[model samples]
Target chain A: MDPVFMGQVLVRLLPPLGLTMLVSLTALAIATPLGLALGALRAELSDKHPASRIIDAWVFFVRGTPILIQIFAIYFLLPKLGLQPPLFVMGVGALVLNSAGYQIEIGRAAVQSVPRGQWEAAAALGFDRHATLREFILPQAARRMVGPVMNELSQLIKASSVLSVITLFELHKAAEAISSANLRFSEVIVVEGFLYFVFIFGISLIASALERRLSAAGALAGAGSFAR
Target chain B: MTLLAARGLVKRFGSFTALDGVDLDLNRGERLVICGPSGSGKSTLIRCINRLEEPDAGTVVVEGIPTTDRQALRRKVGMVFQQFNLFPNLTARENIAVAPRKLLGLSRAEADARAEALLARVQLAGHADKLPSGLSGGQQQRVAIARALAMEPVLMLFDEPTSALDPEMIREVLDVMVELGQGGMSMIVVTHEMGFARRAADRIAFMDQGRIVAMAPPQQFFDAPPHPRLVRFLDNILGH
Candidate 1:
């Protein structure tokens, strides 16, 4: 467990860090709009609407199941159905599904948090449904969703570590490889834990800063006089 | 000629009727005040005018257009709320400019210019950059009025616009509203501000039990209230 040897091993793990970043970022990119749409359907639409009911069931199914099992299902089950996506795609897909479930709740709560008066005022001022959501509703809801969505983003990054179980050489897998080769289990574990902490902590800082910015903009509050 | 009319506007909340066969007419440049005790359909009638609360039954026509024609009706009818429903995320200028920019397709510059002028009209020239949270209740309501005026609506609906303000702040909002009335904006105002009704309203419509119990010129309505319920309400509100 020489310090210099540990540094080399950590550096070797950097490639997997890149893989983690790619998978998580891509998952977030795909999940964001999909989540917003699902969230809007849940919040703004009636329970009787088909999409609303579908979202309700989708959310329950995704949230109720464990993320690890979801990844396994996507990795192992899809191939049986003749959809043999690459392991990377399956991993990202699972992350996207899991992240979108959480994001849908965040987006729904944020969107619903906007006062109903905003919609009424927009309508009274001649804005249609899409215009109201685009111009007035989303901007405000986005401000409120910043902290929560960022929290979810950080979670996705950590969750990507689970992708190694599916043969993806993400951070944990790369570290495990190094530890097994060198027999310095404690040092590799500690170093990998530190890396995860750094990544999640960086995300946490960005989220708080964004939260501050949104609060300072008073963007959400400007929509109405509702006290947070 | 009527610029806005509601014929047989009806609304219900479960078992409670909020509005029943409500009929009202607004001519261009007319200021009409609505007054009633809480839950008397005063707010409901004005809300139906803009389709904010869809009437359970009946037709609302604005300048020969039905409420079913939502965009047409909305563009022509602007509304202010009791709680000053200013877009809380926007500054006074943006709140006033958003509709015109988005709906009227005004260029950003043009909309901002219009917002500036309307803010001046509401005597809020110094507060254009302030968000609703930064402003007082009175200032926010004035900004709300300015936001409505920015639409250049053919008719304005004020639903208890001053009811949420403090006694001291009520005058400032009322003053802006009075100025709008003098400027010849057609208005349907729901308020218990009898003085405002006295000074600005050409007609006063009193509601009770989800119906207009009396409708007359302000002076006639004040001097000789037709309904005993209205007389009692006026006495209770104005006696102080």
Candidate 2:
């Protein structure tokens, strides 16, 4: 439990923070637009809109199955199918699918939470479907989704630890290597835990600030009838 | 010329019928008030005209265009709602400008200028930059009216616009509606305000059980209602 040894582990872990962020943020970047598209399509779901079945199935398959097996399928099985993506791409691919599955639900709830009157108003004003959703609905929904989506991003950050199974040396992989090599399991693990906490705590802080700004920007009617 | 005409309109919710073979017509620059008890389908009829609620049967023609042509129809007709469904993310000005810019291809400055003029018409000139959430209920409803008017719609539909406002606030929204009605804009309003009907409505239609049972000038209808349901409804609305 030497202080110098802990400091060395810290330095080692710090470099991989970039790699960890690279994976999670890239996965998030891919997932967000995909999730928003799926969520928008699903929001209009009804018996008449049969395409939602495909979206529903995709969401179910990704959410119902385990992420570990998904990574394994992409890394191991996909090579047999003549689609051997690099290990980093494989890890990112798996994380994006998993993150987007949850994000679909988050985005759908946020979009639907906008009052029905907004859609009606948009329609009455001659906004086409795309303009209605893009200009009117999505802006409001995006504000509501900010906090929940940040929480989802934090979850993705933690979930990136699972990527080590595919040999991608992200934060947790770096910590495992440092701890086992130095025989400082407790110290390295605790420090690694602290690092993860910092990432999530940072995101939580951003989410709260954004929420406050949004509430102030859209403060309910002077009489406060817009409480919801 | 007719501004709007709905013929044989029918709407149903599962087993219950909301609108049953109803027919309505609006002349250009006319103001018609639709009054009914809950579930009488007055709101449904207005919604169908804008295609907000698709009718199970029949056609709504606005300015000779069928409701099936939703974009064309909507461009000609605007609607205000009970809940004042103003976009929460945009300022009052943006809410009024967005549709014009996106749909009508107005430049930002043009749209903003139009929004300012419309806000002034609705008595919301100073609150242009404020969000609808920060406006009072009456102010929000007035902003809703301005947002609809921003489309330059040939006709307007109001579905209980003041039903959600406080008693004191109701007067402000009603004043805006009265002003718009006198400005020669064609409008169909669903309301229980007998005073608004008497003052602003050229014709009053009383509905019950998904049917328009009576249509007459407000003075004639209020003076001696033709139907027992209308009499009872008037008594209930005017009693207190």
Candidate 3:
């Protein structure tokens, strides 16, 4: 309730903000391209394809489990498998794998949402499948993907809090330390919550701005008539 | 010279036979119109020729080569769809220029120049920068035609190109096709527009139940009519 105390908690939260961003952005940076490739493969390949089946299994497993369990499993289980990565790497790996699963679905849905006529047109124009996907299909799909991708990024940022259990000091862990020490649980929690809001709301703003910019080019205009 | 040949083309969709042991040949500089009732496989035949649909039986040869290399075959053959299928994200000019730029390795300037010329050819010179959505159905179809023509394809396939257009817009697209036909581009058009068939096609073929029942020069096709099915089709379409 006290303005001074809240301001102090906000400053304490600042240092961990960079760590939170680093983990989220790094995971996002690695997961995005990986997810896009998997997503495109999932969308383009038949459900009967072996690769598609594998991707389907991965998506199913990821969606079915909790992020907290995923984080815990990676943290606790990887050492048993003789992979002793640093705590930061472990946290990032978990985030990337977790986000990549969702990203793949997002990518698949976006790519699949493109009208089939576009594919036919690309084929008729003498483009190989790779060129068709890269040139014609992805550009249109990318526009539709912006919102979901940013949403995933926002979720990943918040999810980074789970890394606290793994001893990676991100935003939430920083807040826990401050609140535990000061015993001003309500004040510290409010400031921490506010920080999370500002971060996510900022991303949402960027997302809508991006959506507007992409749509301004008329990519989505008359999209309904894309198929016959 | 024969520009395209399809022999014993058979395509089955599960229990349905879309094309049943069909055969066709098109000479260079020829414009052939194919018309039939719905589900008669006219579109399937053309789609098979371009390798868009693989036939369960038979081979399509173009310029004396079998269509084993699909990308190469498609390079030589262009197709326009009933729906315009213009890339929604690309402007008309980019839509026309993309294939040449990507497939043929044309420079941007070269492709743009070629696209500009095509835009002019299609009577859409000023609309080059407009996206497909900004263009009318007719204009979009025109852009689609220009996009097809940009490949400098030796033969073109039209699958009911104007069937999706408004009544007033149909002629604009048909006019482009007529002009293209006059320019000596070989084409196989599948449409119900008998007037276009009469105007632009050197030969007209009537199909029913997945077979070509009659084929002749437009005058002979309309005047004498070899088959009873053709007679009924003509009467049904032209009787109005």
True contacts kept of each: 0.80, 0.75, 0.76
Model 3 residue pairs with clashes: none
**lDDT (Cα, 0-100) at A110 in candidate 2:** 89
Sorting all predicted structures by lDDT, with the top scorer first, yields 3, 1, 2
Q: Write the per-residue lDDT of candidate 2 for residues B95-196, one digit (tens) a residue.
A: 888778777888889989999999998988899988776899999999999988988889999999999999999999999999998999999999989899
Per-candidate DockQ versus the true complex? Answer: 0.53, 0.49, 0.51
Off by over 4 Å in 2: A45-51, A203-228
Compose the digit string of candidate 2's lDDT tens values, residues A1-228: 567777777788997878888888899999988887688778968835777777777689888888887778778888899997787898899998888988888888888998887778888888777778776677778777888888888889998998988889899988988878867798898778888898778878887887787666553321122211
RMSD each, Å = 3.2, 3.9, 3.3
Tens-place lDDT digits, model 3, residues A1-228: 899999988987998988888888899999988997799889999999999999999899789999999999998899999999998899899998899999999999999999999999999988888878877788788878888898898889889999999889899999999889988899988998898898888878988887887788564442322211
lDDT of 1 at A204: 86
Model 1: CAPRI class: medium
